[model samples]
Target: MSDPYGPPPSDPQEPQGTPYGNQPYGQQPSGQQPYGTQPYNQQPYGQQPPGQPPYQQPYGGSGPSNPDERTWGGAAHWSALIGAFVALAFLGPLLVMLVKGNQSAYVRAQAVESLNFQLSILIYGIVSFVLAFVLIGFLLLPIVGLIWLVFTIIGSVKASNGELYRYPLTIRMVS
Candidate 1:
């Protein structure tokens, strides 16, 4: 039977020539330039074509966004603390990295994290050796102090390249 809304339902073979007939959602119409073709109004589902103008979209004529402005600040930051003048100066950088590492919000945050971890190990080693020496002063185990020093040196070398090492009985006083 037929109804009076308009023409009867067409056959499944009918062609849909509407702009959106063949185009997918959130896509621009084919055969049209991405930019300078349409007004700045709402684009077809707000889609931008490749190699367009104005470089508004990310990864375009102007390039992608820079997170930290590409600085070796991470290394410099840790270096200020680790590379020091006196023998105990190394602890300054190590401790600084560990305490302030979590606050790093840069592209090299991962590097800072690793540096901090390694620094912690170095500091622990130094402290352990010092403790061993103090014990030896009381006529106790002096060899343990020597062993701690050796291990600490190795750890410092490894840490220089950014590694993670947790020392036993260490205190994390800061974030």
Candidate 2:
């Protein structure tokens, strides 16, 4: 404990190279240090230091980010065919999408398109059946029914594959 390292450090608690010189007497670095030991303008422990704000995640690294991306897929472009199938059995689903699903415009548009497709098929089948009965009676019933069936199946398949098809002579219900 002689002065081999130039005046031996004034405080035993502080390690070497503390720009603030020797730490306070009896006070250990773990317990306390001389006032000069702290950096200039530094605040006390458990307090916000000078200049810097508390650490926080960078602007766009992680954590819950965009609401749109989470709620709806990008563009929200899913198969409207699902809606069409649901509407065929129960019109309630289409109505639900029209009202609540409008939270995403893309979903709303697709739902409306699906309802329109189903309505078109129903109308075409009705009109064709009536005309066939009036003109050719029972003879054309099977032929007209077969044609309608073929077209409906084809349309459904196409829609399921994300293709938009317009059926002829169908009333427009949605813009």
Candidate 3:
């Protein structure tokens, strides 16, 4: 009786000596290199081939090359609406700027514009709140709010259309 746990007996009709039957497990059949070794002319990992240029990220300073980039630029302007409800309107444009700013100059510029506008609005709102005690703020506050809404909507539309829109009353604090 054969041992149950041992290797199975070789077949009589099969020609086998090495572990791979025709060649040893670690050896290549002929002039080929070993499994993990690279040939003499092969490039190292992550490097460009002989005549090819290295990979580079696209720069969009002149203009966005694709619709997705335009969308991101537009988002930088419209995101202010989300933060406005919480009285932290700068947070939305600031967030978009930090996340996508490095990848595209168009997005960075739009975010900066939105951030400046929000900051200007904040300052106006604060002054209006203080003036409310004198009864003047009660009127100025609503006007400021209305201006903010209209300008933000216009900026968003312009950005979505692939044009840069500068808010008329925005202080250029952010650049």
Candidate 4:
């Protein structure tokens, strides 16, 4: 192609903006730092910018950022409630228990309790369904449901407080 702006510059010291690009490069205004760099030695936003030593260090030193710390332990315990209402039975607690059990003692215990209770409720529900043919199932079903509801709420509250709670009727099938 013919040179639209004549031949390339002869000087080696010329500032070619965006070396490989066709855009013309220009000098930055005085007192301004280049993109990707901060004024002087300052770090960019979201970074732990360097600062002069403080006269007094803050109380309660912090540990390295821990992913585990961010996970709420109570949710695992409360998953049974979520599962009961949302999954119509056992999937919620099962999922939370299996996924988060190993990450925290709070999660492990709560999830285990919730899982065990859900399993027990599953069995009770089946038994109640069968008893329904005999008329006793109709009565037992509400009782079973009430027990499940009350205990699940208690478990959720205890778990939220970081307190250990065990469902009285839970069978502990999975330990």
Candidate 2 segments whose C-alpha is farther than 4 A from its true place: 1-93, 135-170
**Per-residue accuracy of model 1 over 8-60 as CA lDDT, tens digit each:** 77677755454546677656665455655665554665566657764332111
lDDT of each structure? 0.43, 0.47, 0.83, 0.66
Q: Considering lDDT, where higher is better, how would the candidates rank from best to worst? A: 3, 4, 2, 1
Clashing pairs in 4: none
List, residue by residue over 78-175, the lDDT tens digit for candidate 4.
Answer: 66677666646566666776786555555656676777888899899999999999999999999998998888888767666656667797787886
Per-candidate Cα RMSD to the true structure, in Å, reads 14.3, 22.1, 14.8, 14.9
User: How accurate locally is residue 44 in candidate 2, as Cα lDDT from 0 to 100?
Assistant: 64
Worst 10 residues of 3 by lDDT: 55-64
> For candidate 3, what is the TM-score?
0.64
Tell me the deviation in Å of residue 50 in model 3: 24
Candidate 1: segments with Cα more than 4 A from true spot = 1-91, 94-144
lDDT of 1 at 94: 50
TM agreement with the true structure for every prediction: 0.27, 0.34, 0.64, 0.56
Off by over 4 Å in 4: 1-71
Determine which window of 10 residues in candidate 2 has minimal summed lDDT: 69-78
Model 2 agreement with the true structure over 1-175: per-residue lDDT tens digits: 5767676446777654545446566555544455556666667675676687975322232222344422232112233333345535216325545554546443344445445555665565566677765775356556544654555555445434444434444456975
lDDT of 1 at 73: 27
Report residue 108 deviation for candidate 4 (angstroms).
0.8
